[model samples]
Target chain A: MRLCKKTLIWDTSIKWLLVKKMFFILLFTCFIFDAPVAGKDIHVGKDHTIQTIRQGLMKAADYDRLIIHHGVYHEDSLIIDKPIEIIGKQGAIIDAQNHEVDIITIVADSVTVKGLQFRNVGTTFLSEPAAIKISKCKYVTIQNNYIQDCFFGIYVGNSRHCRVINNHAEAAFKEQVSAGNAIHAWKNKHIQIHGNRVHGYRDGIYLEFVNHSSITNNNSYDNLRYGLHFMFSNHDIYQNNTFRNNGAGVAVMFSKKIKMINNHFVHNWGGSSYGLLLKEIVGGEISQNHFEQNTIGIVAEGATRIIISDNRFTSNGTALDMKGNSIDNQVVRNNFLVNTFEVVTNTRYNQNQYMNNYWSGYSGYDLNHDGFGDVPYRPVGLFAKITNSIPAAMIMLHSPLVNLMEMGEKVFPGLTPEGLTDEAPKMKPYAYD
Target chain B: MLKISAVILQNLLRNKAIFGYLVLLCFTGWGMFLYESQPEKAVLSILQIVLLVLPLITLIFTTTYYYHSQEFLFLLLAQPIKRSDIFAGLYIGLAIAFLAVFFIGIGLPVLLFASGMQSLFLLLSGLLLNLVFIAIALLVGVGVHDKSRGIGVTLITWAFFAFIYNGLVIFMMYQLSDYPIENLILVLSFLNPVDIARIMVIMKSEASALLGLSGAVFQDFFGTAKGGVVSILALILWSIIPFWITHKMFRKRDL
Candidate 1:
């Protein structure tokens, strides 16, 4: 009887082991062939409505992809409150049709929106027009979309580490009833704004209360007020952007550690125009940029520790307008060619360095041919020095008598500020592309 | 004729719509003042907006008012007055009434808000620009027989004044870029009323740094006492040339 019971137990155990092996094989095949339900796509537009898509999205689990298809979807505000990827196909246009405050507000993490056109953004007298509003979302990628006639295009407020790349934003101006900015990034950190073209707006890229942002390779032109206007934003880097014929080129006010490189500012001419207006800017490296035919090349008011080197200031009204409080700034190794004035300043007690810049009007000889002037080139004009203390002295700019007076001041060197000299000014113009 | 002039002036002064237009101007002035942190900057911005908007209001108001008072103009024409005298009287009456509204709405505030002699200069410049626009509008209204088409022409002229005229000048400069034509550029600037207004207002600011190239050229030619005289003469020329052309056109037209 014991031998029979043991045999039955052994048989049952063998059967159980075989059943477990079959279950393992089935699980492996399922893992190989089938993805999670979250990976399924929900179509939008045509026969499928956005509301149905949203319902599908709500039912979807994590890592789900919602594919919004082509055609203009006249939907109200779409609130995506889940962690899902809302991908749009080509020719997918989301027209809020001026019904909602925000066209699409994303509250989920890692949302990717591409190949969509947003238009007719609603604007209040106070609130900004936003086509796509993203807040508190992480790792969002917005790329390759055309946004037109919107107040604020793809506004990201209080978001971090988001990539806003390859978008176009056009906006309206001076319409008392409407309010919108093309691309507004407020209080965002570690954001990348790259390769965008923005025009006909109040401001092209407006940064307020932002830090550690990177704006690179954008073309902003014909903006009503400013091309790239920022206030109180710090530690930002902008490189390889072209701001042409804007109201004012770019206004960097009350910001610090902003590194601007390889930018071009050209033909920003008006009564209130400037190529680059730096008011209270601090601790930046403005290098390798080309400023051509602007009213002013660089308008500095109370700026400090700015390293301006390897830049070209050609055919500008004035190359640099240095103010009284602009201290500890280094204007080094720059090319100032055919500007009306190289440097204009008042009350030059600031510890600024006007060294090693090539002045087209430099007359000093370099016998050694080391590309450095044998005698230090003093770019501070006699008229400018005199006008610092006497505001009315500017009237003598083109007078023949004033030329004689300037020659006299040059000989005496009493009216000019002491130690304000370009000690290593280049003998010829610096070669730049 | 005196009664007609008095009626036009009263209608302009007492109208709520005209007062409402003043409110828009006031808001623009206030908005300019609010955005600019410095008082001087604020004054400059307000002056620019005023220069830009005042002309539009003047042109539109004159064109619309002239159309509305077409019966009155016809009745006066049918009476025992010469056509030229009737036209001159109407023009003088419209100019006077518009100037009164302009002085109250734009001129007084510019004077009150701006500092020193700049205020007075801006006030005069604004008035002159306003007159140029009104004269241009009157010329258009008199020339075109169709009222809607006339209004369209006035609006188009305003748009040209506000936006496209500058574009044309810039395009011309671009075309003439390779030439050493600074003197000719100065001549070209005088052709546009907006450019005149811009130069006059900007020459007042501490932006010689920004205006360096243009200012140097302007100062060389127009910056001296001689330059100042030339600028004044240019302003007077801008005011007169448009009126002269308009008057010539008005005289030749049958209406």
Candidate 2:
């Protein structure tokens, strides 16, 4: 009986030894072989082992990086199907040489393209041929790229969680009718586009069907259409972007829950131009914006629940021109300085409320020392009304008789709508950042 | 002609009203700059003052000065000077005094505080307006010998340029609201000196945007070099034609 029990214990010990040996062997194999699986680098240059970028890319496995050297490569559209990093070493140049499609197309997720230059992209009226295009990808980052003479600089389609940073693009096209946007996105979600400078495109940054995006610290100027345009895009925030010398300025249409903060719209002077055009917007906040020397500032049409506060408008055509459905929009705490017309409305009475605004044209003083004007300021002047009715009448604005007529109208309060007045007009301008 | 102009200018400079006008203008310029605290804001206010008050002051002052200088002109007319030289001397003296006022009052402040294309254009516009209105005063002064009638016509002209003309243009726009009368309005704007000055200055300023769509039309009319030349030609015509007509009337006058 004792002998049989000892044999059973020995068998248990041997089973334990076998399990420990297998674990050590597995650990050794992983430590030796798994190092190359997660990390690998292939060089693309004349003297390198990989002669071409395509060869380097083919040799690289998933999660491997392909380093491109400093040389101008005459390549067409190259597709990346693996999760890898394409880092251009020492600012490598990729000339498309009039390619058929995009210069660089990335199809895989978790891919990053950085420190590269793309030039001479193909122009097509049908498909969007961009310098760099990402489609149906996730967790992608495109940064530090310089693109010139391209139809579209950086384009993303059906992508999510993408970051576009520090890219400069200029189209230099005279015919802007056929030019695409500099940074065009469609069907993208959770994208962050920041620190970009774009010029001479149809639109600077255009988004359609994009949501949950943030655009910040970008300078978009001299575009054919809007500096920043959105259609059916929702829950987006754009801040600290300068839109200057654009054709139509920044326009947001059919969007909701948008926050536009601390932007500068400067010198977009055209007959049909506006500093910021809001149409069909719902639940948006436009605050701390600076509109300087623009044709018109804050033209709202068919918008609802928009809060326009703490904005500085200097030398605009009209500070705020509204028509169509006013729908509970609020204009408060803005400085309207040296504008030709303060407020022009399509209708005599609007649903909007104007409160605590400072007008350079205001004649009434703060008599009671309450920091508010003693008399309510009527922003809609006779000239504004006449101009609204007949924009052609603006050419007659220089006649001294118009001043007398305006003065008479102001005293008697007949022609200009009386209800379009700021009740609590501020005596001082708000210090907007 | 030069000696006569110098004498006329010196006599005009001794006049207290011109001194007071200069003081008021300089004070206003300095006060606007002080209150506004920025050159751009100061420039805008100066623009309004130059547009409205400067032309009116120039009109009334020129007409009155011409009437007041009637005896001096008769004395000069008795001398060996040509009729054209006398007329030219009187106009040039008065214009120089007004130009001095403009330079000290508006022009100096603008050059000191706001040095830009816009401010320079506004100053130029103000000076142009001074010349144009003086020419108009000269025409009315020469054509109508009766002091009351001449002053009346001058007042009427000022009223028309300052206020009534714009009113009539607005009425036309209202009547033709259905049509695209922007071009017609542009043509009519060039007819008035004030309108021309306003358009020229406003279009040159970055606030050219303040004209809005009308600005675009104005730009097409006055933005290009060719457009600029056309408007300049028109302005020259406005300035010279009135003076030419007055010169002819002065040369053939019974005075």
Candidate 3:
């Protein structure tokens, strides 16, 4: 009986030992199959085993870092499908040799391109060619790149959480039809485009159907068209950017909840140019902007519930050209200095409000010494009204006839639009930061 | 004629009123340039002076001078001088003296501070304004017999050109607001030398604002080199017509 019991105990112990061994084998196999391998570094240069970027990309695994050394790679249509980081050394150039193809096409998520220079992607009318084209990407970073003379620079489409920072994109094309935008994004979300300088493009920074994007500290100048063009973009914030010498200046159309603050719009003097053109926009905030020497400083057409405050309009042709359809707009606490016509509107009745603004042409006295004029100042001159109706009458500008008509209108208050006066005009200009 | 004009210019240059006018203009021109930070703003202020003060002062001064210089005129008539030569001499003397004062007073400051094509246009228009008003003043002086009536006529003429004609134009524009009066306004602007001068200066300086739709019409007419030449010719005709009438009236007058 004792021998039989000892045999049973040994049997049970061997079964338990078998169970332990099986569990360890299972765990070891799982570790071997599921654990991530450490990413490897692939170098591409004249001396490296992988001499070209295409070879480097081919040999690279997921999450590998491709280090491209300082040399001009005459390559085009280089597609990056794997999630890899491409770090270009100083003087690293990817010359597309005027090819009608994208230089670097990124198609994966979490792909980073840094410190590369792209050149000479030729203009294409049939297809959308870009220097660095990103499609269907997320967490993609395109930073510190220089792209010159390309059709479209850094074109991103259907991207989310992408960053395009510190990029300098320039083109020398004269015609607007031939040139493309420097930084173009379509159907993007959570995009951060900052510290970019774009010049001589059709549009400097353009976004269509983009939401929750922020464009800051960009200097966009001398573009053939708008410096920044927004179409159907919502909840976007653009601040501290300068739009100078652009054809129509910055146009925000079909947008909602846009915040344009602390921007400088200067020298956009042309027949139809505006410092800021807001069309079909709702609930936008434009504050602390400097509009100087523009043909028309701020043009609000079909805009509603826009708060334009604390802006300085100096030496503009028409400081504010509020169209007839614009309603519920508030223009307050602004400084209007030396503009040819202060406020010109197409409507006979004003639905907007202008309050606490300082006008250089305001000749009313502040008898109460309350820093507000006793008399409400009418910004729309009769001649401005005449010019609005009969554009040919603009020849009568600064004429003694116009002056007399203006004086008569002031006394009678009949010709200009009704209720279009600054009720509390400021005695002095606001001190902007 | 040259001898008579030389004497008249010497006699008028010694007048204290002319010197005071020079000082006043100097103070005004320099003060405007110093007060305004922008040369454009200063130009606007100087424009007001040129438009308002210059015409009034020139009209009053010339009419009074014409009346006050009756003895000198009789003295010149008693000599071997032709009546046309005497009239030519008087107009030439007044023109030279006033042009010199205006050039030195406003023109020099403009050249020093705000030297551009715009400022040059301002100076040109201002000089032409002085000549037009001077000729108008001579017409009144030669046509009217009474002293108060001549001065009165000069004042009326200045008022009509400077303020009343503009009021009439505004009235006409308001009455004819429905009609396309752009060409009509352009035609009316030519009739008044003050309007022409004002348009010339303002168009050059404020071309950006004037490049709008209706402004484009004026800009197309005036912004081109052809437009500029036409406006100058119009002003020259304005000056000559009044002076020619004055010369005709003076030649036939029984002095």
Candidate 4:
């Protein structure tokens, strides 16, 4: 009876081991055959069996990856409708061959295109042929792409949680009027644009109806129009961006809750050019910005409720030109260094307040030793006032008579708005590097 | 011409105005360098001061000298010197004296503190303005028969160039802003010698950044090497025209 029971236990143990082996084999086959739920990589190259990226995309299921090898592929347009990742190897080239309306159109969410070089997209004004256009897509990342001579470099429309990272976008055309914006977005939210080198476009970064976006570390130069143009975009933070030699540095209009920080605007010298053109903007903070050699540093027209602080304005034609309708704007802790005009306004009285600033042209004494000047610093010069209405008065920019008028007005402030004065002017510049 | 020039130089250098000008310029020139930390800015401020004050001094000094030295002119006229030689000697003597004073007074400090293209440009413009104003002053002296009237006209002309002209331009531009007078206004800027000199100085310096669209246009026209050559030529013409008028009037004068 004991021998029979042992044999029965041995038999059951052997059956259980066989059952485990069969289960693992079934899981292995499932992993190898059914890769829909689990994503896989499809290799595409001239040498690979899948020669085209379009064929790779067709074969790839949702959430799969297309690993493209280094080769030149002449494709007009590729419509990506699946949640896939298209990563190009080093020196991977995508030649649009000048026939496509759009180079790479992303229609699905959670798609990524990285390390690809796109070139020679045809032009049509009716619809801009972008090197990469993400339409109605979310959580998309387009990074490390070098796009040259496209109608538009990267166009994002109605997309959210999209990041455009480290992309170099440039055009070879001489006329910027025919070129489009490098990185353009419309009606989008939560977008991040950083580390972009954009040049020779209509505008460097154009955003209309965009919100909650962060733009940082972009070097935008040589654009025909404004380096950056934003209209109706709100809750945006732009920091650590350098704009140089553009038509005008940046124009922020009809936006609110913007934080412009630590940006460098250099040599935007032109007629009607400004380092930062703030128009019809509300509730923004512009701080730690360095504006050097611009026609006008900050031109505020119809701007309201903004904090302009910690900015350095040097060698500009006019430092702060408040046209009119500017209300409750506070300029504090700024360094105005050798600007032609410290402040110029056309209003009856100064609607904005100035405080705790260091003017290189400041003549007041610091008696209290508290680093604040004893006399208030009034920045509205007589020449500035004259030029507000008469631009031709600028010809006499160095007339001692105008300087005399300013000195006289400083002693007795009446003709030049008496309300415009920095009550606490700093004896020295703030700790700015 | 040489002997007369030496005598005129001795006579003018000993006058109180030159001494006063020397003291004022030295004080302001070094003071600007010490006060403004930026060298370019010091040069610019000093340039503006020179533009405003230099012409006034030149006008006053030249006109007053011409009027005050009536007996001396008569003495020189009685001598064996040519009429052109006397007038030319007097003009050159006065111009060189003032130029030397200004050069040492303003130019030295600028060179010591900030020696660059900007400083050189300022000095050049200052020199040009001084010569131009001297010519204008001499013209007014020869044009008017009376001393006080000549001084008055000179003063009025200086005021017009320095103050009233800019005011008029402002008024005109404000009135005509609706019209596309961009090019028209730029051409009008060259009408004033002061403005022309200012364009030369400001276009190549840091002040060019302050010039907006008008500045851009001015730079496109005046910021180039060709622009510099043209502007310098125009400024020379400004001085020459006034000097030629003065020369003609002095040559035909009865005194």
Where model 4 places Cα greater than 4 Å from the true spot, the runs are A1-43, A46-49, A59-67, A173-177, B2-20, B63-80, B111-120, B140-157, B164-191, B205-230, B249-254
**Chain B TM-score of predicted candidate 4 relative to the true chain B:** 0.95
Q: Give the alpha carbon lDDT tens digit for every residue of A1-433 in model 1.
A: 9999999999999999999999999998888766663376777667675544456566666677777777776664677776667777888777767754777787887887777788877666666658888888888888887887766788888899888889888766664235466788888888999999998777888898789999999999888778898899999999999999888899999999999999999888764478898999889989999998786788899898899999998777678888878889999999887665678777745478988898876768888889899887767777666544433334333323344556677667776776778888897767777
**Fraction of native A-B contacts kept, per candidate:** 0.09, 0.60, 0.37, 0.57
Q: Which ten residues in a row have the lowest lDDT in candidate 3 chain A?
A: A392-401
C-alpha lDDT of candidate 3 relative to the true structure = 0.89
Per-residue lDDT of model 4, residues B126-162, tens digit only:
8888889999998998899898889899999999998
Which residue pairs does candidate 2 place in steric collision? A271-B213, A400-B162, A400-B163, A401-B163
Tens digit of per-residue lDDT, candidate 4, span A1-433: 9999999999999999999999999999998887675588899998899999889989999989899899999986899999999999998899897864778999999999999999888877788889999999999999999998888899999999999999999986667667788999999999999999999888999999999999999999999888899999999999999999998999999999899999999999876678899889999899999999888899999999999999999888888888769999999999998888888888778888899999887878987699999988888877777767656556667766677777887787777887889998999878797
In the range B1-255, model 3's lDDT, one tens digit per residue, is 988889999999999999998998999898888876668778877887898889999999999999999888998789887899999999999999999999989999999999988899999999999999999898888888799999898888888988888778767776887877767888888999898888888777655454665455666777778878899999999989999998998888786
| TM-score of candidate 2 against the unseen true structure | 0.90
lDDT of each: 0.74, 0.85, 0.89, 0.87
Preferred candidate (TM-score higher): 1 or 3: 3
Q: Write the per-residue lDDT of candidate 2 for residues A48-167, one digit (tens) a residue.
A: 877677788789899898889988888867899988998988758888887758988999999999888899987888888999899999999999888888889899999999999999
RMSD of 1: 22.2
TM-score of every prediction relative to native = 0.59, 0.90, 0.86, 0.84
For candidate 4 chain A, the 10 contiguous residues with the lowest summed lDDT are: A387-396
True contacts kept of 1: 0.09
Candidate 3 Cα outliers beyond 4 Å, as residue runs = A1-51, A69-72, A89-91, B1-6, B14-20, B23-39, B81-89, B103-105, B108-117, B143-160, B163-191, B224-255
lDDT of 1 at B248: 74
